[model samples]
Target: MEKQRNVLQVNGLNVAVKSAQGMLPLVQNLQFELKPGKILGLVGESGSGKTITSMALLQLLNQKTMNVEGSIQLHGRELNGLKEKEMRGIRGKDIGFIMQNPMNAFTPVYTIGNQFVETIRIHTKLSKKQAIDLAIASLEKMNLQEPSKIMKMYPFQLSGGMLQRVMIAISMCLRPSVVIADEPTTALDVTTQLQVLRELDRLRTECGTAILLISHDLGVISELADEVAVMQKGRIVEKADVYRLFDHPQHDYTKKLLQARPVLSVNEELSKLVI
Candidate 1:
């Protein structure tokens, strides 16, 4: 059988922002590929360009003050330099994004049901009723309680974990080819973090959705990622399978990061997360 093609491909990606000093690079020559049903964890400390890379892929960076160069392809379609109208069509349908702050994903003025239903109708031909049904079902699949009641609530009414899962439900309902989860579990408690991670894992296993999992947490990376890419100072310093990267990291930065965390905790969490 022929090998399956990658679901998402990023190559030679560079992002720079304007400054008094001149163009300051936020991400430099970043490159990675994500196959269907696979999670490629992008791990780095704060200011390591992980979030910038995601913004570039989603074409969300402000062009007025920033420059994003090189290829960001989904299902072999070039996304760089596309018009905003064109990108809008692709953003939720072809690729989904889950941000660290669930509140950012939602508008305060809108009820959860309104945003969820509207998002569904935007990318698909589903009617309002159908969209509501799908939205509720998706939330239920995430193990959320009282999906209907939750939908009636506004963004402010839900807890952080509930809001995050609702966001995941919205992202996964469309079954996008890839999902970019940027620091998704950062604000959640340990139990909520595991719940979110498990939902993401389910997205891959059940729906074949590729995921770009970006977090500074190695334990989280070890739990979900099939492969890991270590980023430092706006560049990828190392990329490897999860086990290998943790067991015998080659990069000095990677080594230092691992040494900084407790091995037993990571391993215990990894065991719980791995199916």
Candidate 2:
């Protein structure tokens, strides 16, 4: 057996926003790679440039207001500075993105079926009817009940967890090589979060999809990520295997983050809350 090649690679990546002084860097000299069927968790606090890094990879940054420098390669294909039209074709078809807010993933006015079918048709040659069937099957895989009925509904008609699963269903339907899940379970309850995480795990195991999991939650990172990258002040301070990073964090910031995880009281004793 041979080791799988990296599905996504970032080297010397930097993102900057125009300011009065000059181009202010948000992410600097970032470097990492995500292999097929592996999850690389990017953990950081707010304003640490985690989200910006994701956006830069997807070529979603506003070119007029922001500048993304360095290499962002997907399966050896360079993505940096691609035209919007070219990027559009790659966004959902090659690299799937699961946003923090499920509501942001869909439009409120369109029927779910309509949006799903259109998206599928755009990337594939399937007829509308065939696309709908594929969509329903994808939803069923996520354990969404009454998939047919749900298709007729609007985005606002569903719960947050349902919508999140729906987004996952859509992403999986395309079988993207890489999936960038940015705080995907943030709005869901504990049980729902578990479901989402499990689904992500299934995606990797079953379909060999590489994932970039970005979250501020150490617990989430610990549970789902094979490797972890700790970000602070717009730079990756440390990168290590999940277990090693947790047990023997080298960076001071990494240690601080581990210490910051919430603790629970057990028989009048404080115990670190386990994921």
Candidate 3:
């Protein structure tokens, strides 16, 4: 079998913001490759530039305020300096995004089904009837109950968790080759968080989505990431396989992060007893 091409690659990426306050560097010398169906978790605290790195890949950061350098290639093609119209096509057609807050993304004016159908029509060459059917099917895939009712309700009418399910459904409908999930499940409580994250993992397994998952939660990273990139003050201090990073963290900062995270998993439970 032929080796699969990488879905996304970033090399020596630098992102900086300019303001009256001064030029503040966000991300520097960041490099990573995301293969098809694998998830690389960008783990860091706030102000560490995890979200800035994600924005740089698609050129989504405000051009007037932020300047970015280095190569961000998708499937062997360089994305740097791509026109906005070109990037728009790639944003949803080839790469999907699940934002941190569903409310921030979900339009309150449109019914869920209408918005979903619109998304399907925009990304896919499908008739209105076909789009509606596809939208409903996507909702079902998210394991949502009363899918029909959800399809008809507006964003404000649904709960946070329900709205999140709708957002996930929208992102997964076309099975974009790359998915950028930026703190997607952080708004939920523990039980709902598990449900959402597990569903995200399931989607990756089924759809071959190469994910750039951003989250400060180590427990969440342990559950979903194949690889981990530890970020601090705009740079990745360590990048390693998940198991190795957890078992033998080479950097002091990485080890401190691991130590700070509360023990939550069965593996950690066993380790506690062994210790």
Better of 1 and 3 by TM-score: 1
Lowest summed lDDT across 10 adjacent residues in model 3 is found at 261-270
Please tell me which predicted candidate would have the highest TM-score against the true structure.
2
Model 2 stretches with alpha carbons more than 4 Å out:
265-275
| Reference-based TM-score, model 3 | 0.93
TM-score, per-candidate, Cα-based = 0.95, 0.96, 0.93
For residues 97-187, could you state the per-residue lDDT of candidate 1 as single tens digits?
9999999889999999999999999999988999999999999999999999988999999999999999999988999999999999998
Question: Poorest 10 consecutive residues of model 1 by lDDT?
Answer: 261-270
Summed backbone clashes in each candidate are: 0, 0, 0
Taking the tens digit of each residue's C-alpha lDDT, what string does model 2 give over 151-231?
999999999999999999998899999999999999799999999999999999999999999999999999999999999
Model 1, residue 227: what's the lDDT? 98
